[model samples]
Target: MASAPGNNLPVFYNDLIPLSSVDHAGYRSRTLDSAPFLATHHAVPLTVDEFVSAQRFLPIIFSAGDEPVPLALMGLNEGVNTFVDDQGKLRGPSYVPAYVRRYPWMLAKLRPDSDELSLCFDPTSEALGAFEDGQALFEDGKPSDLIQGVLKFCEDFEQAAGRTGQFMKDLKDLDLLMDGEVAIQVPGNEQPFVYRGFRMVNEEKLRDMRGDQLRKISQNGMLPLIYAHLFSLQLMRELFEAQVTQGKGPVSVTPAPEPAQA
Candidate 1:
């Protein structure tokens, strides 16, 4: 079920295989009671289109690397998701990222050299299988209405992902990205829990930019997105507090920082 070797699979997906009428004719998409795949994942990839809504609920940060992707921070530490219980259910209403919503299914290139994308799904997920009571995946040896709709959603997600890629490229070209760190000290803990290993917009460089550079970003709508990321940084402490409330915080407060996931 693994794709071509050397390619890293996205989070929440164990293995991917093409979904087709012939191979999965009897498969039905069942609504699972919980999302076990999301239980321990703290970082979720986000499209530029979702920044505004996602920023309101989760801190938006960029991954650490040359080709950094925007991520919505669900928790301060790796292998922890405070918004979701161990059972994989949300604690309350929140803006669910499209990356999570498209779980178990995505559009991927079947061949490394091909530009065409195929509808692929994670075979490991229980969401799609031959179930007696769920919606059919295909009808009359063809994709059902539901499958068609899923295809449309996946296609749209790909488009949004492209735009997100361009936005990241622009940020890199502008040299506005800087290594990020967040330190939060609890009332009782003498030492603060320091979080690092991510990237964020460099506000100092932004202020030092020439007027034309600032105008270019503002006119092209990148300014608002940058501000959204900056504004969301305040929620990092909030997420840490929630983790403490849930009894999933670091074992002991220390001066040394923990490495956050990219």
Candidate 2:
């Protein structure tokens, strides 16, 4: 028999794969209670590939769906870093493809019955809970510490490219989600990656950042904030796409950020 939502099984004790139940206390899934949620409603999915590409949601892949998709992982993250060609060499960022940005909603629209499927408001409730927890840790730890930690991430990458650095010096001013003040575009084209009212980064500072920023950093290029913000919006696209693929119910998730650690 199986256990409740947040209890029992998969324990650990030094070095032992026991035949019996282990009952680890720390391992628990995130909450997906039936609460009223406020998310974007998608009567019709968008038409952009960056919108539904698997590479964008690598950071939160486990949380995107209850069950896993049978595709290989790409872009930047732990677990299966690079893609191989006939020669068995790691491919570059070209793995995602230039066309995805133009057809973002293809994955969700692949199934004709997308409207019948429900959205996953809290697929990786546990991971979302952890991010909320991490936020609170930053909030309570120290402003200086929090700012330094984030800035260090940006500054380190910038310096690793054989250059000196200036510091960000503030987090309150560092939106990192703002569109900044530039427009990035693919070569031979004037328009940048846009959805509804959102746009990808087109500035300089963020283009150098790594991780999610690196993934979203198009060949057209933009700054850091664009990467962070656009990555988030892309995740929503994937979440909706998952619904269409699985044929679930209306989307919803628990609202409040997870409680801070004591």
Candidate 3:
């Protein structure tokens, strides 16, 4: 895709190429042996469709920016994913965001001027290549069933993204999003550790909304998603504890002692 540098690229996709039958006739897709690709990501984009199930496991929050995207928090710090261990094995059972499962394959526009999107794959991904024992990407100059399935998944993800965009727009239109902050008091600590840098639905505003407005949101299936997000906030502390268990919690900053008697 012809996007600005570093704009279109998702996590772990070093290079993306349009999958053409002529150019990739000999290419094959391999099964994921490990998930080391996810070790560096503390959060992954989540679709609105996933909010209900994902909220059961991970805390769902919105990224802070013009285009706010829902994220499933895997950890609280940079380059740390409490869910994925050093060996790339999941620490426990949790909902895996479709964004992570769709890695190595994505839909992208071949040219900036083109309105049609094409199936693209990460050329740098070890999960896909010309392997001896793997599913072929193409057969008889046509995409194989495996490729077809991946394409279908990408299409579904696009649809979900559209719905997610609308959900975010509704939240914005209602002015319900607010700066997300949390304070957790660690045992034996005098001050509570504060966390910020995400956006969340303003429960106060939501509660104060008119009955007609609330009914409209509920009828459109957005009220549940909103409540899911609100409920997921409780997991933030759990995530922090996971980080602490993994030795990636907040660093202790010793307070400076008062000089003599001043």
lDDT values for all models = 0.82, 0.25, 0.80
The TM-score, computed over Cα atoms with residue i paired to residue i, of candidate 2 is: 0.21
Q: List residue ranges in candidate 2 displaced over 4 A.
A: 1-55, 58-169, 175-222, 253-256, 259-262
**Native-referenced Cα lDDT, model 1:** 0.82
lDDT (tens digit, per residue) of candidate 1 on 117-169: 78888888988888897999999998999989999988888888888879988
TM-score against native, each model: 0.91, 0.21, 0.91
| Tens digit of per-residue lDDT, candidate 2, span 195-253 | 22222233354444567645543442333323333454444433333343434321232
Q: Candidate 3: minimum summed lDDT over ten consecutive residues — where?
A: 253-262
In angstroms, how far off is 81's CA in candidate 2? 22
The local distance difference test score of model 2 is 0.25
The top-ranked prediction according to lDDT is 1
Give the count of colliding residue pairs in each prediction: 0, 15, 0
lDDT of 3 by residue, 33-74 (tens): 568888977878888999999999998888876667788888
